[model samples]
Target: METESLVETLEAAGLSPYQAEAYVALLELGTASATDVAEASSVPAPRIYDVLRTLEEREYVETYEAGSLQARAHSPSVVLDDLRSRANRLEAAAEEVERRWEQPELEAGGASIVTQFRTVIERAESFIEDAAHQILLSTTVSNLQRLAPALRDATERGVSVRVSVHTDDAETRPDPTLFEGVCVEARHRPLPAPFVALADRRRASFAHHPDSYDRYGVLVNDRTHTYVFYWFFLTTMWEPWETVYEATDPGLPTEYLDIRHLVRDLRELNWQDAPVRLRVDGYETDTGEERTVEGTVVDVRVPFASEADTGFELAGRVTVVLDADGERVSVGGWGAIVEDLEGTRLTIVDAPTVE
Candidate 1:
């Protein structure tokens, strides 16, 4: 390193500018009078004595009266050790910066904006690991591989994990075997899509594709915010995609946190004339009063055309007509207004008994 840069580095390592310059000069001179060091370095002759004395106190130099007061640089071993320690600290700090850039910490109960897509993926993995009931994830096949372990663990714990794998084309689609045990179902989307992960309706992670003009990510722990991302996943990445992999039916008594999913399953069961019983847990839409209703599902209604499946459109109503004892109660999903009850948890209490 240049002498000037060496002096600057020494200053950064806790030595004053004059002390650093004087020490550097004495090292070069072998041993020098205070006046000689000032002439050799940029330090002023008037301040050289005090600067050398301070360096001596710091053990960077040993000063003694050699005819007149003289300063000699400390052993190179001691100085080199201090410089090496500083370098090691700086290297560790650099690693920490990169780690935070990739896996930034997200605060609880709100949304955070981050600059790296990796941050969203890491947050999503954490949410998947903690997921109790359900997970909806839309990402590239490579990211699917990265999160496979966490998703598999969630499935082993009985969490419903649905993955939408986006690819550039059918030619680029991954093998179905890749998702066999990692998720309950895997869908193939033939277009580039933003990464999204929603866990148990409460936490969500979203990020634009790296190719996007504005690259960023959002981590959300609020139910309300995640609900929006859930719809985005449904309309864009999920409902429209073709199913590539589905686990063998671990048939009934299955539980659903999404009323839309519940409605879809009920539609199929009703077509086969299967008897469906449910334990509906939620709040009364009108009064926000909690209610649990155990009944048989009599009807599944979606306000679109009779033949139309509940696809991306959310403009119409989707209701489950439940016969509770003698009274018929209309149950709806998250933001239910037309229905009497807003269902939060729906468990199929009876398995299909179709012949």
Candidate 2:
């Protein structure tokens, strides 16, 4: 087994079996004459000189006395150092060649199907690492566990990460503890089969075999296809699942952020012509005093066409609340809608199903 391993290693390193065996024999014997090396290594006596000479040329062996047949194996340290140096030189040359190489342009609407499970996971990880703005992803609980570390790393780098997980297993439900500090938000729903990841709305991948060990998937780069997938994620996978976790930065109160999401839910529900039980607690426009309104949403409008209407252009005083009669009031000036609405606790009842 040792001899076979040595021969294989030597062959991999560009040495012939005879040269490797001869070198190994010399190393074992410490020092030997050419005839002794051939007998010990089982090399044919006639060809031993040729093998030794080749090893000598490669500095794997050194003839002690140039005029005589005596030879010694190069010190293992010396041989390893030479090999490392050669490898580093080759790597540098490769980098230079790669720098000059031109990649072929990939035309739009081309899709590549990968049948390997590892390949799909590798592509998902690659997209997560490359994401700059946000990641929209849905998979099973086990799969989320597999990707949690990469997702955390991306979040730490200031990339936003939103994940939806489907779990049939009762023992695990997309453990948010795994991504406690890094993930921006995460939710759990029934298994959203065919795991998918859409990054920055630019790259997308969909698995055909999410539940099986033998997973097959398609990696898509076409913008149009990715956008379609993105909408599917937003409407189907992301919007329906209850948000199990949300990590907000220091500036905004956690409750304030909650209001933002709930308000968005209300807006979307209203847009679908569904009844919503959303109530807001804030200063009334007429009385300039704290008030509460609880009823079905009549209309939620963004009255300020641009920042110029608010005079504080960057403040983003865009959120306007209206009842059934078209009565409207600004929650917060420009950018502080949710924060402004949180003068006191606001109760938003569970949204009615949009059928």
Candidate 3:
């Protein structure tokens, strides 16, 4: 496997470029003077003193009176152990700040999220409140399934917890409900997303994907971001309890059925080039133009958020996937052709099932 990204790993492990260089040089040469370290590390002699000082404080390097200040590198494991112990202290400090202080401008920004899955659960559990209006969160199944307790604990604390899940394997036992003070429902949707957390919609957290060794997340406490996502992208389900089966009558257009069934048919018929179907709820309040909209996926270019850069347009036909209430949402052909991708939202333009 490729080694960790050197610049990122060294910085994360608490090393300045100069310090990291000095340590690596010491490791290479066994023991070296400041001048030797400077040469080996390619750090200038003037900056080497500051780097050595920081490394010494972090316990990654040791220095002695050897004819002009010789420095020695600590073992990798030793350096990491110290780094971790310091990290624990820092985490404790962060939790205290997260609790005791209202604003933590002085606290380090975005460094102390727990990495281990169980540890993340424990951290969430620790922060959970017993009041009714506590935290509101949504989770994908790929995550949180292992440490399902986080959801349960939040609910047990009477926090309003809303959950949506996507599953291809419908054969498993009914997944246990993870909350008590709130609603937990199971529904199938797209690939579960990572890093979705909103607390009371006033403060939100984004889960940054973990490093390859251990998965982790970054928490964003931005409220505007939370509000935008809540209104637009991360929609919580407001639907019926039972599975709404399709009508047996052939009068309806074939495209307006549950997308699960359509994908099944595609796989069953061995149609290698089937268009990606749009799963849409019927629409009302239209000029009847959408009634004849094709359900087949088409090529449409979607732009990334850029003005100067030519953007990504989804390749697919315009089709109405879901037309519930006033809004409609659909997946554009992922690689469609379009002049600009920035403003394009709907992919499959369509009419209602019946006017």
Give the number of the best model, judged by lDDT. 1
> What would the per-residue lDDT of candidate 1 be over residues 232-341, giving only the tens digit for each residue?
89888887779888786667777764677787777667633666888887789889887999988888887677624655346668788888998999999877888999
lDDT of 2 by residue, 1-355 (tens): 5877877777767788898889988988888899899999879999998999999998889876556587889767867987688788889989776533321122456657666556666678888988875677887767777887888888888666877777664355656675586577787776545688877556787776455765567777686787677667766677666877878542222232223344444554453366554555545444455576654544444445622232212222345343524454334421143433422233445455544
Best by TM-score: 1
Error of 1 at 16 (Å): 3.0
lDDT tens string, model 3, 1-355? 1222554456666676666667767777888888888988678989988788788887778888866888887667877776688789889989886654332221322224443444444333333343233344444455546435555666666444554443334453234443222333333334334444445433444443343344664343344454554443234321222322222234323431122223333333333244443433222222211222224443221233422232222222322233334334343221212211111112223323322
Candidate 3 backbone clash number: 42
Give the alpha-carbon lDDT of every model.
Answer: 0.84, 0.64, 0.45
Candidate 1: C-alpha lDDT: 0.84
Error of 3 at 9 (Å): 22
Over 4 Å off in model 2, which ranges? 64-68, 82-111, 116-122, 125-134, 145-162, 169-187, 212-214, 234-236, 239-355
Task: Please give the RMSD to the true structure for each candidate, in Å.
Answer: 4.2, 12.0, 19.1
Ranked by TM-score, the better of candidates 2 and 3 is 2
Sliding window of 10 residues with minimal summed lDDT for model 2: 306-315
TM-score on alpha carbons, each prediction: 0.79, 0.53, 0.30
Collision pairs in model 2:
315-335, 316-334, 316-335, 317-334
